[model samples]
Target: MRVTRPMLAVAGAAVAAAALAGCGSGGDAAAKVPPTATGSLESLAAEVKCKPNIQTDADTIRQAICTSSAGKFVLATFSTDRGQREWINEAKDYGGFYLVGRKWVAVGDDGVVTALRGTLGGDVEIGTDHHAHTGHTG
Candidate 1:
């Protein structure tokens, strides 16, 4: 079959749309703890010096007001990656740094996050953005 210009254009548009659709939260936004984040709350708290103060939001999310080598800020973690990926995509705008492990996301603006990211091997990665958050991930 001879592919006409219009046929090529339609195929190209369909491919482009499919590619864009694949690049999202994957499914409906349902919150849950990712496997990696199950025990990460405690670890992150210890690392960020929020040990005695870590606050859990429904056991699926953890947050704390902590101070560390990087500075003082709120550290948050999500059990599932539902919205975490999207958050990481736009984190720099809100001073977001993510350490994704399997299914969990640990977010902060501490050197520890950067350090832990190295240990992730290759989970999920986001470039540090410091323009909005004032503190860079590194």
Candidate 2:
């Protein structure tokens, strides 16, 4: 059977759709939660009823410290996914709870992060304590 251009187009579209469908959920409970907003640090902070105290505002990143009845947390937005991942990797060494969105991360105590998740609707990530990995001698 000779494949036609139309046939190839249809097949390509089908493959793309399937790939998108798989990405839609990412097979995670967090994906199911609808974020109040994404894209900007302010918007994400506002979702949790926070008046952000701007910390670092730059081309590559925008970060703020916020406080509410739930607690205080640091919210940061990155310019790229790569940047966000790198930041998270380095931050994990400090050990804390994180609520992650598309290009933003909220860092705080476990309770604060969990509460942010309820409103911000993002995945919860736990940072590893560097001390635990150290080979310390008494």
Candidate 3:
């Protein structure tokens, strides 16, 4: 068999595509936590250098109050993506900031959330204004 320029080009393109696919998370490396960070609420908290005061422990969610140098915040790990989304949706009405990971979420004020993002490697989601609920009777 004789090698050709076209065959070499095709092989190179396939290799490049495979390499990009290995990234898995849309190639956004900053949006993923380290391997050890997803094990539990405690481990995730540890990544942000917090001591968790666990508040809710259930089959669906585990939550804690954590105070790191960044400040105090709520740390929670969920059993499923749907559960996390539901909880975040409800919590957002209270008006706060969220640092979200695979199955975990951290709730705090803007500064705290910003600080947590540095160590946690997740996306920041802003909550709706709590004051919006004041005038509504229903």
User: How does each model score on lDDT?
Assistant: 0.55, 0.85, 0.85
lDDT string for model 2 (3-47, tens) is 788899999999999888777855464555675458688777767
- For each of the candidates, the C-alpha root-mean-square deviation to the true structure, in angstroms, is 10.2, 8.1, 8.2
Global local distance difference test of model 1: 0.55
On lDDT, who's better, 1 or 2? 2
Candidate no. 2 TM-score: 0.70
Taking the tens digit of each residue's C-alpha lDDT, what string does model 3 give over 1-138?
A: 356878988999999888878776455645453432466998888888888999999999999999999999999999999999999999987789998888999999998987787787678899887676688989
Question: Of 1 and 3, which scores higher on TM-score?
Answer: 3
- In model 1, the Cα lDDT at residue 94 comes to 53
Ranking by TM-score: 2, 3, 1
